[model samples]
Target: MPFVEMSISLEGVSILLKIMVTGKVVAVGNFSRYIEDSRKEAIELISKLLGVTIEEAEEEVNITKGLTVRKAWLKTWWSPNWKSKPFTYPPVQCTERAFLLYLLSYTLFVDKSGSRVSIALLKLLENLDDVGNYAWGATALAYLYCQLGSATRVEVLQIVRYLTLFEGWVYEHFELRFATSNAKYMDQLQPRVSRWIQKHETVNVGDKLA
Candidate 1:
């Protein structure tokens, strides 16, 4: 996700995405068009994914969202041995899909609150095989651009986007002459972030935004 220099209009995103930036918001495919489900269906899917009963899923959803809107908390509820881990009774394929959904929520489509995520996204992840075919990168880029625009407001407090992509783009496009070289960095397979992140140290991307 490297960002090249587009000195005039910052139009490098088209080159990076390999598609023209359309005024109609990405002209990729007819994906995610009909990916909608009822709250009851989402709750049932969560129950299956987390190996919990519908009652427990409903309760957790209430606790996380204060009501059963299309959002769920991700912080304390889903991390550190989250109680609703996918059970072994379902197929391992189910577990894989659950993990993939969680991973996407935590990374690409992460919320600015850093705690809750839209349950609407789960519908998009319902079909595991077709997940890769969606214009996920384009969606992420669009969301990131939107967030960037909103962040320019005078009353803005915080900004949230795929900072990994931002930082990776910086690392790839610029020379890190002042930064320390990573001894364990693998030139072939490792991401650019590996050169900056130290082992056993968690870096918060938001804290250093200034």
Candidate 2:
């Protein structure tokens, strides 16, 4: 049996590499329900990886949706590779899990800010590179900041600091795999600060420097 690490990119949004135990497949029935369960499991896995308490992980992932397994094939979101082969699993690989957390964090921060959720997100996708788990971490951090906005309440700051520290720790994996220039990525991500600043034109510098 070959223990293969396969790196797959999906629709330019995110990249996921799985270490598959080949010939070891888990057959699933009721795609929708299974898919939802898969997502929850993915979050739990990441939370475990990040060493977050169970309570904290639950607090972070508040809104979980239920899916119908019979109708799973109908929705591409449930399928990691919508255009490619169908996955027997809900496709909750490490990369996908990271991306989900990232988006959830972003939504929290952005909504916390004054910008309407729609407009804030409309800006996030611009120049967003959908590569590597680190990119997902960056995106998630951005979202957390958006959810936190300029006024970082004590509790929100704690979450932001915890996640940002985790981001620094996990970034090495992506650096080894992708080997893209850090300077370049930093440059790309800097634009997000401008967007944040725009929202807080009159705010103090200390408050907005996330």
Candidate 3:
């Protein structure tokens, strides 16, 4: 059966969803007492305007990633390719593939019991270019990595490639500007940075120091 994926966008936030309708709303409901009841009424109105039965109108409701808006789905007969149609925040091929690899590696190898993995993930995110809700996605990834800390070096290295790809594409190729605007900020941090260097602390990636 064909499906209608209803996506809603508000102030650049978008969510694609699937929903199933339970029943028609009969009353002009108050929003305060029971918000769900009011929502049902609103959906019924939408269903009538769209020329579909209420049952056919709600198939799934999903809060898609990188979005702040609400979306409800009304499945309808349409082309099978509808699902393949790209959303606004479509995944970039290289970046998405790299991220997937990293996730798999984390699942297989990372040991999840300490703050080390969390710190690493946070550092990776802090270094990435913030674009198109990507920071949010990265934050989510960081949380996952932090939570799943049983990962081995092999898996982490695999994921790091994706992170490096992001760095190269978003940082190097795009020539994006850093948020730092003041020379004073750099000057103030220089001494602390010197101390950090003197401490001889360095990140070791695989067998090499980064």
TM-score-wise, the better of 1 and 3 is 1
Candidate 1, 54: how far from true, in Å?
1.6
Top model number, lDDT: 1
TM-score of 3: 0.19
Question: Which portions of model 1 miss their true places by more than 4 Å?
Answer: 1-3, 7-38, 48-51, 66-89, 175-183, 191-210
User: What is residue 88's positional error in candidate 2, in angstroms?
Assistant: 38
Candidate 3 lDDT, tens digit per residue, 1-210?
A: 111222211211111011111222112224333245544553454344333356633431112111111111211112224345542322243233223223323332233321112111222222223222232323323433443353454555333211321221222123335512224423222311111111222221121100
- Tens digit of per-residue lDDT, candidate 2, span 147-188: 446446655443332232223223323344432333332323
Compute each candidate's TM-score over C-alphas.
0.63, 0.19, 0.19
lDDT of each: 0.51, 0.31, 0.26
Off by over 4 Å in 3: 1-34, 58-77, 80-210
**Model 1 — which ten-residue stretch has the worst lDDT?**
201-210
Candidate 1 residue-wise lDDT, 39-86, digit = tens: 456577667654557997677666654322232333323343443655
The worst-scoring run of ten residues by lDDT in candidate 2 lies at 11-20
Cα error, residue 150 of model 2, in Å, equals: 38
